[model samples]
Target: MARVRWWGTGLVVLVLLILGLVLPLVDKALGSGGTALAAGTVIAVGTERAGARPVTFTVPAAGWALDEARSSLTSNAEVTRGEVRVDLNLVIPLGSLDNRRLWDGLGRIVAMGGGRLPGGPSAVTTRHGTAGLTGPLAGHGKIGSATVFTKSDLGATVTASGPPDAYGRLAGEVRAMVLSVEISP
Candidate 1:
């Protein structure tokens, strides 16, 4: 007869328990593979130079100003109003990478950074192409939204954040900004 080992059983149980706790998170991070933007209308408020690169996009609100903007491996723009801050990031991959892959890659990076969309990743249409949206995740000093899109060799991410009260006030305009994003040639 084979002897039963309690420690072995306990170890197996522990591993299972850990997986049980982690599986949901992993599943959430992987997403449902269904793409649906949350119900809201994206509004376009204005336009500005997005980064040091010659690229530009529509701003969702009127008061935002470029505090600091630059370009390198990634082109980044930071806009601010009161305590609210918005960051626009653009990356032009030197090698071949398509939109879906680029979106997923950025999604994983966002998830690892503890930035989670309230509704997780979803499908949304941008000026350029279909993109992924995440958050309402926590940002530097407020709640924020992250949107990622890719076209040809370029991948872009926009993060908008502000104080909870202020964010609530500007939420619709912000959504419009996401909808109105247009990359300038």
Candidate 2:
């Protein structure tokens, strides 16, 4: 009985020593791998055709994952941290439309109807061209905003929403992403 007890204690001590040494190494490896995955890398969002300047933006790899259900009409991704969920989308105008008309029409589509948005429509400009921005619209169940811009024959829209305070915090990063968008001239 004494010998058996000694063997059991020795086994427990060996297991504890192995775990203590291995756990810190595992943690360190994961920490560095996360930074390496996100470092200076920007994902391209848009079609790759003969000549198209797709929007490119960098997102932290740890908290964000690219949603895979995108279709021709909507190219999008999502990021979540704590209580906030942000949906990033590049909305393509359906069918064929002239550049001038599309630019003009953005307000109508985003407005949805009069009295829907807090401040109605306002003129805005992006790296690509002049755009219409609207919302944090009323009755949307969440704080939200939309930006409409054009590139060559394509029109793009970005909509973002979350709890008002959290959404406000993300606004700068969102704008930076939008500004980084380069449309082929």
Off by over 4 Å in 2: 1-40, 51-53, 58-63, 69-74, 79-115, 127-135
**Residues forming the 10-long window of minimal summed lDDT in candidate 2:** 31-40
Each prediction's TM-score versus the true structure:
0.56, 0.54
Expressed as tens digits, the lDDT of each residue in 1-185 for candidate 2 is 45445888899999998799988888876542212224334555567656543554455334543444432322555544433444445545677644345534644664665414456456666555545454454334556565556665665555556677776776676565555544443
Clashing pairs in 2: none
Q: Once model 2 is optimally superposed onto the true structure by TM-score, how far is the C-alpha of residue 172 displaced, in angstroms? A: 1.7
Top model by lDDT, which number? 1
Each candidate's clash count:
3, 0
The CA root-mean-square deviation of candidate 1, after full C-alpha superposition on the true structure, stands at: 16.2
Off by over 4 Å in 1: 1-54, 69-74, 111-114, 127-135, 139-141
